[model samples]
Target: PAAPANSGPLTRPQPVSLGMNAPAGPPTWFVCGAAGAGLGPADSYDVVVRIAHPESVYDLDLYGGTTDPDEAAAILAEALVGDLADPHPGSDSRRSTTVLAQLLGPFKAVHGRFPSVPELRQLLDGAAGPLAALRKALTATGHESLLRELDARERQMGHPGDVGAVLADRIALLDRPAFAGFFDTSGQSRPFSLKALDHPVRVRIDLPERGHADASRILARLVLAQFTASVTVRDDRSLFACLLLDDATGVVTPEAVRAVQRLRSANAGVALTLRTLDDVPRPLRGPLLGATGCRMAFSGLTPWDGQDFAEVWGKEWTEARDVTDRQIIAETPAGKAFTVVRRVITGKAPTARAVTVRQVERERWSASELAHGVPAGHAVLSLTTVKGEHAPPLLVDLRGGPRV
Candidate 1:
């Protein structure tokens, strides 16, 4: 018998809380006893991992740049860093000084050293001159102010307040290693190079964890790695380029999403490892998932995350039922059937007989099941296709040697 129905608060079972599954063990890796085989640059991939700890030196060279979502990210490695912020290379007053330094590089190469303003102008006049196209584009873009600023910076390159001089000085300070040079083939540090490719050299850079991390610089380097790989991969499909980023705290910009969309065609890939989905911004959750086609979710995803994944996998027809009445029959003293009532109950209570049961339809794989059911070793693998059909999800074991 059930307790008396009351107007008091109803008692219910405690809600279930998911457990955090510990990793199986340390990662498996073996030392190479034989002579080291270097990875070719053309077949190389650059991976960046960020952790929430002491910052690394590689982060110092970060330069955050952006592009419209409707537009693809573009990078001209041979171009100056100022170009990162503008599609029209020399169109920003803020980067006038930086632009002059670019022209100065070639000017110095042509002559024995730095050229005069007249010499630089003469260089810009050539039919195939880089600055000619830039200036022409500036006029087309209605950036008269930028052109004026460029003229001002060129004339004041040697002045203390000169934009070009200031930019050149800043560049000198910023250019420490190959990390700053996007197109630099001879990346001075092996730790900062790509892993392996069919090219002559590969580079890898591990951020140091000994000091306070620079948020802006770290973000810059991450964008650089992601954008550079994405750009080069498109130009050269024969090369294998990738970025393995760990602790990607702030990589979810429109540019990053666009990069993911564009990378597939370029034969480049960027892999990021984050602590939790909560670490990412809310607006980007769908895009992040959509960009990643093949996904394996471990145990203990939050209810929201589970719901998101559940929705992706979709709903299905499942068996369910409802209760109507309860009826029981018995013979009393070998005569006939009799009914007995032990306790009085509410209107929905079953009669003192057979328990009531009815068939009803319900959806399967409720959000809670995904958020809490599976054990530590097992994971749900859901594959999403471009055509929008989700393959039936599969359960997998992380440490299992192989699936025969």
Candidate 2:
């Protein structure tokens, strides 16, 4: 059946706790790489994963390598199982283990199959017997009812598939309550269903290149998943933030930008940086550039790149002013000399705005002649002092500066 409008966006079953939970804020950064280590060491920032909303925020450290989907799935399963183990020590490890095995099992059994939450739940439910036995063993050791709640959850949720569905549904529900409730005409909303909330301010993705296509797919999926999570819980007043930084070229695919467009439509902010502008594929350039509000140019050396930058900044601005190559003509008593100057001279020459370039020189008497110097901020002064051996510094009073 065609899904209803309120059915919300279709999503792959994501680990409930693989996301972040915080009030939404401006999207400041988006970083993409093979591992979280690429962003920096773990000590750099606080890391948290939302078990209930895997799409929201995740620890990139867990999925670092570029492995096949099956291998990746297996890795994710192991990571999740490991996390659950500490909280439910007495729970049946077999079920959790089996659930992953089935999803990532060998010989095409696990191939082409991305288990939804419901599928995972069913498998886990089947392993309940083993879990129950383990629980009983723990109870005897003085941890009674250690897994009773989990067992009860299994029963209340019914089939393993249903449990998975509920978890997925709840995660989604949390991001889109109104839309989620629209489909439930019974006048009573499901208690644990997903609800829409404000989009998160930041998201981090791990993209490892096991295969070109597969890695691209993973990046694409991460982008879509984040956008889906954002829209389902966006607030009107908030600007969603997406920061994508990739160390590897071609790690982000066209699908990634398309997914970002979805977020942009929801009024989200996005910033994506690659090794170079050329790293952005030609096909995806338009939308990617359109989504960005600002562009920053660092030290670019390539001739083609220099031309590309000129094209991007437009010839009108570059030609309308006499600042090409930052050259300036200074009239000296000896003759007219052309000097290469470092200044940002804007507008047309005679009637244009002029500013002086700040320069730092070593203090001759300082240190064992080992005193070093560095260039600093900008300053503006009269050009008549250009050839003067000694020039007085000009100071403007900010209290009475010209008002625009």
Candidate 3:
């Protein structure tokens, strides 16, 4: 049934609580933005997750504002389907053919300028059989159009001297399989290096589970490769990864994990989101947690999660109890409002650890609750300082014109 006309706007009821054993790996950071702030109409949210360890480092952003829910979902689905089907086993074969064709064009043009027709015929005959037939067809016609066509075809076939040899060299060098082997042997072309780019900033978009996985993966690789290469070649700067994740329920696949791991290994900064701690995948729990040092928790109704947070604070305060306790008394008009106070720890001391756990609550939107045009809920923005000193801006200005 359709929702009632007077029904209130949609809103997340409350966050689910997590247990103490909430995955021991990397910290899984999450954010649930309001409709316009970070979440979009396509049932998507922007997220950023970063992981840094002593041996390895990873930074990734799962959601970029530009990707729509449909597009993202489609990419996810396509990746899954493609992996299962394993289509196009020899797609790289075409690259060799293309390089060969390119080499042929210049070769023919150079040979075509020969002083004698016999020399030209000899050169053509010495080439492939199809090339020789093509030359004959052109000579027999003598028409300017046919000659021009033949010349063009010959040039495309390649330059005269060792054209085939040069093609072989390039094929061995540029072919994907060969290239992979070279990298494997040389150790310079690891999976991390394959996707590395030279960009100061890289924007990544994480799609919802319903979106196309393949398309999203392609889009991400293209954007990252283009930006990284352009920035590196043009500016000679190291590549940086800026990412966003839009998973309402933080269920990610093994492929996603591997892809993200590759990105992080390249020293890219990442940002991602999840609806709750439980939504995080079991396998990814450790790496995700270890990567993200900064965290933000919004309003949650789950008692267990709240209690877990309370315990963290309790441990921090354990040392404070040992210190000299101070007492204070307060008087009220209604009655004797007496209160006892103790010295509160503030720095890196054991007692102060618990104080770091901040209490955050969800915010409500102020616009008309029943307005047809208004977005669902009010957005809450939280910033975490991960690897860098500066945090990216989180603006919520609707009047800034449409986003491309």
| lDDT by residue for model 2 (1-404), tens | 01111111111111111134213432333343444334443332333222223342332222222124344443333323222223343223234333344333321132233333333333344456544554455455554343444355446445633323322322232223222222221223221111122333223344434333333333433333443343534456353444344442443344345555566455443334444556555655555544344432322223333333333333221112233243344578333321222223433222234554544433222221111211112111111111223322222222245421
Q: Who is ahead in TM-score, 1 or 3?
A: 1
Using TM-score as the measure, what is the rank order of every candidate, best first?
A: 1, 2, 3
What is the RMSD, in Å, between candidate 2 and the native fold over all Cα? 21.4
Q: How close to the true structure is residue 398 of candidate 2, measured as C-alpha lDDT?
A: 21
* Whole-model Cα lDDT of every candidate shown, in order: 0.40, 0.34, 0.31
- Give the lDDT of residue 28 in candidate 3: 23
Best by TM-score: 1
Best by lDDT: 1
| Candidate 1 lDDT tens digits, 1-404 | 00112101111110000011212221111110001112112123233322221332232122112221111112212122322333433334334434444454333333334433233334333324545554565567666655664455346544543344433333333233422333122223222322223342222333332332332233334444434443543433554444434334444544466567776565555555444566566767677777766555556666777766666556666545444455434457432212323223333323553344555544345468757885665667766544457666676664463521
Error of 1 at 35 (Å): 24
- Rank the candidate models, highest lDDT first: 1, 2, 3
The C-alpha RMSD of each candidate to the native structure, in angstroms, is 14.8, 21.4, 21.6
Provide TM-scores for the models.
Answer: 0.48, 0.34, 0.28
Model 1: ten consecutive residues of lowest lDDT: 10-19
Tally clashing residue pairs in candidate 2: 34
lDDT of 1 at 59: 26
Residue 80: error of model 1 in Å? 15
Q: CA lDDT of 87 in candidate 3?
A: 35
